[model samples]
Target: MKFLFKTDYEDDIRLFPHSGYLWTYGTLLVLIAAAPFVLSSYLISQLVFVSIYAIVGVALLILTGFTGQASLGHAAFLAIGAYTTAYLQQFGVPFPVYFLTAGLLTGIIGAIVGFPALRLHGIYLVIATISFALIVEEILARWESVTHGNEGLRVKTIQMLGTTVPRDSAGFYYLCMGVLIVVILGAINLLRSPTGRAFVAIRDSETAAKSMGINVSLYKVKSFAISAAITGLAGCLFAHKLTFISPEMFTLQLSIEFIMVILIGGAFSLHGAVLGAIFIVMVDPFLTFLKDDIPGAIANFSMLMGAGAERAAAIEKSTAAVASANGLKGAIYGFLIMAFILFEPLGLYGRWLKIKLFFQLFPLYKRATFKRQKIYVKSERNR
Candidate 1:
């Protein structure tokens, strides 16, 4: 049983509140540092992608989870960053300058979108974001001169200060990991600051927050800008990672996947972003494997139905259905979102908390210790 007894106010707010956390984080860092040497090239590449998604996930968490704003158009910000980097790189701009430029430009766009839509909440805001995403996708497709339309754009190797990092190189992977670490630390610090508190305050109760003199509208716009900036940085890295990108890549499905990361992992917690990224990245291979195995399973089942022309025709239809099911990735995401929302609102992080508490309490743990409670009230105002 571990106890984190706070000695002072500083201890309560410290990033790592206990000595156990220090050792655990230190060990995790050491393992990450050694991963390039110990892991296969494929695994290393996957981790690179995980790092990129983790950055985006954290950005969404800040906006949706902390600020209580919803955006179904985050892919638009990503598309902006990617295209910005691709366009600027072609003009001989260095990686750092173009990268930061992408974030800045995307942040400005986010603020523009947020200014008018921030006043709207719930489904109205979601619809607005969805419209924004569709508009951006159309722009990307129609702007053939700049974005090359559906032909897509090829990205060159990223060049830092006198150093070039190729997409497949270990240096590129380390660069991504380094950026992820920095973003995680920065997010943690931001969440502990006054600005982060204001975000949470707005999320909890905008009316109460306004009563306390918090500028609700300004902070909402700021939240959008900051979230877009972070996601845009991830997009810059994503472009370099893939070495090629098309407008089709930043679809509504991609935005949904971003939301899934925080939803399944735990929206209100920073670790949830990383956990969700890992789950999303790792699950892709499993899904692919299932896609492959399903056809064989279906064929075997068809054989068991006995040999006949009618059976053969039915088997063929089943085979086609199974093959088409590969495109059900969006359906899978929707199912996962629904399941998490209904059964585990706090997400995987919440489950982790419960397990940790169980272990801490040991034999004294009660079955109802972590059970959720429901409260209902009848209102005369409704009548």
Candidate 2:
């Protein structure tokens, strides 16, 4: 009997060991670490942008997705982070210190914001958060002395350990990717911990969670702080990447875009954060190419139909911006969200999981019988 127990324990340990996950994770880390040398400059830059967005998206997901706290003012945190990093750069602070400070400052702000959630519910809290965002914009735009009042602030090349990192695309990409990996892994760990579960419980039912002796208020606030911190890190990266900071960069549109990413990627899933970021950020370039390369009616008709070179040039000039502003990103995001809601509400990862399950039992994968419907059925019925 003892041998049987030991054998089962060994099997479980082998099958679901920490080393296995670590090995896979470490391998990924190595790839990301070495990606800069092999990847082209353009692709590297794209990946860097992806990393920045992923950081912010993950931050938002932790708060809204896992903690069930709706935050519309997340850009406020990003603003805080950007300004902080810019200030530090202007003042000649060390890179590591500046980065950490950015996160810490935003985290403090987020904790303060979370306090209202203790007393408010649903849209009430959402409104307050939105108001906070608007207030931040006002500050950024009006604080001419500090924020430069829409003139924007310049960010010098980020220096690490007294050595200036190259501002070239590849170096920047490597740096962003490295930061992204750290933040992502940290988020994953947080979600796997007791604190994360507490957030989830509070999100699902604060009253029930409280009844079960969970410190709902504390967790809610903590999640907000953590979420803000993650975004702040992203903001720091953004400032460094762009070498500029402006109120316009952290607009309400950006806040909405972040939320859209969360919705499209699947709320509360880390993988969703990544997938959403890639989708939102990549859509612009992809569509731009489709416009130029495809040579369809939309492109040629507009080009040829213009009254003359003056009008034609003007029309051609507007094409890029018009294509950009036509709300295709929003439309695609809305469609994706609706599709996920209707067909795969659990998001892309959920669909992938179902497909994997289908393949795992391929020969046994039969049509759903009235007695045994595996894909979709009432939870009560399944039991």
Candidate that scores best on TM-score: 1
RMSD of each: 3.6, 6.6
Candidate 2 ranges with C-alpha deviation above 4 Å: 1-23, 296-327, 364-383
Q: Output the TM-score of candidate 2.
A: 0.81
Whole-structure CA lDDT of model 2: 0.79
lDDT of 1 by residue, 107-225 (tens): 99999998987768877899999999999999999999999999999999987878888887789988898888998898889988989999999999888999999999999999999
Task: List pairs with backbone clashes in candidate 1.
Answer: none
Residue pairs with backbone overlap in model 2: none
What lDDT does each candidate get? 0.88, 0.79
